[model samples]
Target: MKIRIMIVDDQALMRDGLSSILQLKEELEVVATASNGQDAFEKAREFTPDIILMDIRMPGSSGVEGTRLIHRANLPVKVLMLTTFKDTELILEALEEGASGYLLKDMATDTIVQAIKTVYSGGVVLPEDLTAQLFLDKRKTPHSDLEPVGQPVDRSLLTDREWGVLSELGKGLNNREIAEALYITEGTVKNHVSNIISKLEVRDRTQAAIYAVRHGISTTYDF
Candidate 1:
């Protein structure tokens, strides 16, 4: 089955260009296009695409707000942010709003295609050169002493297999990569991921990864 997608960009040329390139891929289908965040949100409900490539800045209902609304609505769609800025605060805001990944506007065409596929297949995507900076900036920022809103996490609740899966998630490894590392099938990895999400009580792998990293599991999971 082809992956269904929506392209949301304020620039007509950008939207058309991306749509044109994506249409050439046999495994992908551009089901919809929106000029702004509000339009994107509405079209998302109408088309119900598997993925949305969203611009960070828009005239009305910016991408961050749209992403939050989509997440709050509990849609099954995954959002991948498209932006020209590497601004740490902006990226973190999108992530906090439940964006699955962020990609630069100038990224190579092949990389952009693969990023959509990667996020669609349940992996977190960030520009390779910018990931370290993002993490470091986030860590340096002071967080409030108040606990985050969620069930108190107890790593003890995870099984040995789930621990392995959680560790890989923290490292941003997709199902296929996790399968190869653990000598399991991709189907098994998917099952493990679902089980881990349930156990962790998180919205998605991005949240799961943040939880794992906070508990120090990510330190050893790195490549």
Candidate 2:
């Protein structure tokens, strides 16, 4: 089945151009297009596409605000932000608002398409450069005391093995690499990953990794 997609951008050229390119893919179908965030949400509600390709900067409304609105509405669509800006604050806001991935507009068209596919298949995509920027100066960004809306998380909620796996995630290790590093089977790693996500109240591995990084927890803190 072709993945339904909605392209949202302030510029008509960007929206039409990207839609033209994306619709060429056999795996994708351009179901809708909108000029601004507000229109994007309206189109989303009307069309219910599987994914929305959002741009950060727009004249009437911003992509971050759109992401917040979409998440609050609990639409069954993933958001893949495509923008030229590398503003860390905007990137963080989008992530917090449940964006499946963030990509710079200058990326190769092939890469953007692949990111859309990845996000469609329940995977998180983060540009390595942007990821490093998120991790590099963590000390400088004022820490958010806000936790995911739930009962407070504690170290006791996880087993030592789960903590070890989460710390490896903080280092950006994939399942295979984490398994090899910890001398555990990949299936075991997958199981641990599932448990960690549930225990941490995170949507996915990306959020779990962010939680570990923010808490400064590591394998050394585990068994």
Candidate 3:
């Protein structure tokens, strides 16, 4: 099945341009286009596309808020942020709000199209050149009491199940993917993720994922 897609951007030219370019791919279909984030959400609820290409900044209801809306509403669509700006804080905020990926507007057209397919297949995407910057700027060091990296983390602090979830989260799989990987209920995965965050004392799942990477705790499960 072709991946259903929605293009959301403040600029009409950008939205239309992306829609035109993406429609050429036999594997993709541009189902809808919205001028801003709020409009995107409304259309998302109505059209329910498999993926959304969201722009970070907009006049009313930015992409971050739009992502949060879709996430909190439990929509089935994955959001991939597209923007010209390279702000690390916005990247973290978008991911924290449940964005599946972030892409620069300057990237090759094929790269953006592949990113949509990647997110549609339950994978996560982030700009490579900026990930290091994100880690250095937005990724916080774990709390003082948290176990130091390379040390064996106490199982008591985080159970084996929670560890599994953490590892999957580190790989940037959403809850559904993690549940499928671990053979657990999504509800159970959510519970484990909550516990992972509380036990790790990180600000959010984004930070928790970063911690998982920094600690070399990651899943070997094939994507």
Q: CA lDDT, every prediction?
A: 0.81, 0.78, 0.78
Model 3, 38-100: lDDT tens digits are: 898999999999999999989889999899899889999899998755465676678778887
Stretches of candidate 3 off by over 4 Å are: 139-210, 213-223
TM-score of each prediction: 0.79, 0.75, 0.70
lDDT of 1 by residue, 99-167 (tens): 987888898889988988889887887553365546655566698232332224565778888888887
Candidate 2's residue-wise lDDT over 1-223, tens digit each? 9999999998899999999999899999999998877888888999999999999878888888888888889998889888655466777778888887688998888998888877776556666445544555433557844432222347687998898988787665778878998999999999999999998788888788666655555323444
Best candidate according to lDDT: 1
Least well predicted 10-residue stretch by lDDT in candidate 2: 144-153
Off by over 4 Å in 1: 139-163, 185-201, 211-219
Go through the candidates in order and give the C-alpha RMSD of each one to the true structure. 4.3, 5.3, 5.6
Instruction: Give, for candidate 3, the lowest lDDT window spanning 10 residues.
Output: 142-151
Clashing pairs in 2: none
In candidate 3, how many clashes are counted?
A: 0
Clashes of 2: 0
